[model samples]
Target: MASSTSHQNSLPLPIFSGENYDFWSIKMKTYFMSQDLWDIVDKGFTTTENPSVEQLRQERKEKQRDANALYAIQQAVDDANFSRIMGASTAKEAWDWLKEEFQGTAKVRSIKLQTMRRELENLKMKDSEIIKDYYSRLKGVVNQLRAYGENISETRVVEKILISLTEKYDPVVTAIENSSDISQLSVTELIGSLEAFEKDWVAGMILH
Candidate 1:
C-alpha cells in the first residue's frame, strides 16, 4: 500500500509570470508591512523612514508655533471687536482679558523657539485672513446653536450688537470693492444713515 501511494501522481503547480508574481508580491508585501513601513524596500533595509525623536519634536514645535500665531491673531481681533461692540462697558473686563489672552501678531511673531512668524513684515497677515476667520468663528457659533436647538446666550446678545456694528461697516467694504464710489458719500453721512437705521429699527422693535 505504501509503495502504491508513492507512485501516485502529484498535481501540476501553475506557473506565474514576473508581472503576476510582482502583483501577488505587492499584495503580500502590504500584509507583512508595519504601519510605519515605507516599503519592504531593497529586500528589507532600514525598513521605514521612522522620524527621529528630534525631528518629531521639531514638527510638533512648528505646529504649535503656527497654532499659537493663528490663535494670537484671532484673539487680538476678537478682543478688539469685543471692545468695539461693548463700547464703554468693556473697559475693565476687556482689558483684563486682552492682557491674559490676546497677544498681538508682533508678540506672537516674537515667541521664543517658534517658527510661526518673524520679521514685522510676515507678522502683517492679510486682512482677508482675519476677516475670513472672524466670520468663520461667528458662523460656527450660529451653527452650533442651531444644531443644538439652543438659544443664543446673553454673551451672544453682545455679539449681536457687534454683528450690527460690523454690518454697518459694510459701506466701506463696498466702496473698496467698487473703487469709483469711495468718495461718493461723506463719512458723516454714512454715520448719520447708520444712526437713523438704529432709530428706525429700535422704534420698530418697540412697536412690535
Candidate 2:
C-alpha cells in the first residue's frame, strides 16, 4: 500500500493556469479517473441521517476519498488559480467553480467557437512562410477548434491547406491533385511533398 501510494503520487498532474481550460479540464478529469477519485469529485459525497456500522464505514471511506480528490486538485493548480478555489469545501464544488469561471456559459462558448471558425476560414499560407511554419500556424487554429468541440476531419484540413497555399505552389498543387486522390492524402504526406518541391525550387533559383 505504501508503494502503491508512492507510485500514484509519482504520476504528474496537469497544472491549470487560467488558459486553455478545455484542454486542462480534460487532462485533470483523466488524472482523477486514474486515481479512482473522479466519482467523488464528480457526484460529491452525501451523508445519511441514520446509518448502520457498515454504512458509517463506507461514509468515512468516501469522506477520505473526497479529501484526497480535493488535495489533488489543490496541487494541480498554480498559486493564482488556487485562490479561485480556496473557499471550496468539497472537491465537486472546486471542480464546478473552476469550470464555470473558465469554461464560461454555453452561449459564450458558442460565440467563441464562431470566432474560431472565422479565423480558420481566413487562414492562408503567406508567400514568405515555409511549409512547416504555415502548417504549424494552421494546426494551432485547428486544435483550438477541436478543443472547443468542432468536428474537423483530416480530409477537411488537407483540402483547406491545398487551397490556402501561395501561387508559387500552384504547379506542385496541380501535380498533386492530378496524381493522387486528395481525399486519401494525409496532411503529413502532403506537407512532405510540398517541402520536397520547395527544396528543389530553392535549389533551381540558386543555380540560376
Candidate 3:
C-alpha cells in the first residue's frame, strides 16, 4: 500500500536554475530592446559634459584620489599574485573585466568607457549594481544586502570603506614603508613619518 500526497513532488529538484535562466533570458531581451531608454531616462542624469570650474577642480582632485585607489588595488593584485583574465589598467576596469569573465548570468558583457566617466559613466549602478555583484559573491551574501540603491553607491558606502581604511591603516603602513626597522622608530617619529609618506603618494596620485 502507498500513501497519496496532495503535493506533487518528484525528487526535490532545484527550481533556482530554471528561474535564473528565465530571468537572464528576459533581462537580455529587455536590454537589447531598451535602445531609447538611456536617452530618455538620462535626461535627468549627472552628465560628464560641460563640467563647471569647481567641478573641473574637483575632477583633478578626484583623479589623484582615483589614482591612489588604482595603485592600492594594483598592489593588492601584485602582492596577492591573483591573475587577471583581461588586461585592465585600473582597479575599476580590472574588477569589471573580471566579473564579465567569471559571471555567467549578467546582462552586459562589455561596457563602454564613456559610460563610466561620471560615476563611472552612470554605470555606477545605484543599488542595482551592488545587488548584481552581491549575487556573484558567496551565495548567501546577497541576502544581507540593504534594500536601497544609493545605500550601495560609493558616495555613501565604498568611499566610507576607502576613507576608513586609509585613515586607520595609513599610520601603520606608513611606518612600515619608511622605517628601516619597525623596532627602531619612536612612536612620535613613526606618526610624523606616516604624514610625510603622503607627499610621495599625493605626488603619484594627485600631481602626476
Candidate 4:
C-alpha cells in the first residue's frame, strides 16, 4: 500500500515538442521542483579543488543529483528537441540550450506577445456562438498572452467579457453590471450567470 501510494506521487513529466515552449517550460520547471532537482538545473553545481572529506562527499552527492536532473530533462523531450540539447554536459546547459532554441530572443517574444494582445482585443462573442465556446476561445488567447509575461488581471478579463458579448446578451449583461460588483465577480461566476441567462432566453424563444 505504501509503495502504491509512493508510485502515485510521482507525476509523469510533460514531453516537449517543437511547439508550446512556454507551457512546456513551465511544466518542466514545476516537475524539477517537485523532485528537488530545480536548484541544480537553475544554478549548476561547482567542484572544489583539493576538497576535505566532507566537501568530497557533498560534491559526489551534488554530481549524482546533477546527473539525475540531466537525465530527467533528456527523457522529457521528443527526438527533435532532444537533438537540440544532445551536446549539453549539464542540466543547466541543456535547459539553456533548449530555451534559446525554442523561446527565441526577447525581441521575438515581444513581437509574439504584441500579436497575442491584438488577438485578445479583437475577440468577440459571435451572435451564434454559445457562452462556453466563446469563453474557451477567449481563455486560450489570455493564457498565451500571460505565458508571454502579460499581466492580465481577472477583473480585466471579466470586463472584457462583459463588453465583448453580443447584443442578445445586453439585458443579462446590464443586469449583471447593475446588480453585482464587477470587480469581485470571478470568471467562473460570470460564466455561470451568462449560461443560465442563455438557457432561459432560449426557452423563451421556443415558447414564442
Model 2 Cα lDDT, one tens digit per residue, 1-208: 4775677689998899889888898788888888888999999989987998999999998888888889889999999999999999999999999987997778988998999999999999998999999999999999988887799999999999999999999999999999999889999999999999999999999999
* Best of the candidates, TM-score: 4
Give lDDT for model 3.
Answer: 0.36
- Ranking of predictions according to lDDT: 2, 4, 1, 3
Q: For candidate 3, lDDT tens digit of each residue in 55-86?
A: 88766655543344344333333322245522
Report the lDDT of model 4 for residue 208. 100
In the predicted model 2, the residue pairs found to clash are: none
Segments of candidate 4 deviating more than 4 angstroms: 1-10, 47-57
Q: After superposition, how far is residue 12 of candidate 2 from its true place, in Å?
A: 2.1
What stretches of model 3 exceed 4 Å from their correct place?
Answer: 1-47, 78-86, 105-208
Q: How does each model score on lDDT?
A: 0.37, 0.91, 0.36, 0.89
Candidates 1 and 3, the one with greater lDDT: 1
Query: What is the TM-score (0 to 1) of candidate 2?
Result: 0.83
Tell me the lDDT of candidate 4.
Answer: 0.89
TM-score of every candidate relative to the true structure: 0.18, 0.83, 0.26, 0.86
lDDT of 1 by residue, 1-208 (tens): 3442233213122222222322333333342232122122212222126878887776564444333322222333334344432432222333333333333244542452133212211222233333334445545444433332345544442333233345544554455435534335443444455456556655877999
> Which is the leading candidate under lDDT?
2
User: Which tens-of-lDDT digit does each residue in 52-161 have in candidate 4?
Assistant: 99999999988877887898889899998899889999999999888877877788877888888999999999988999999999999998887777999999999999
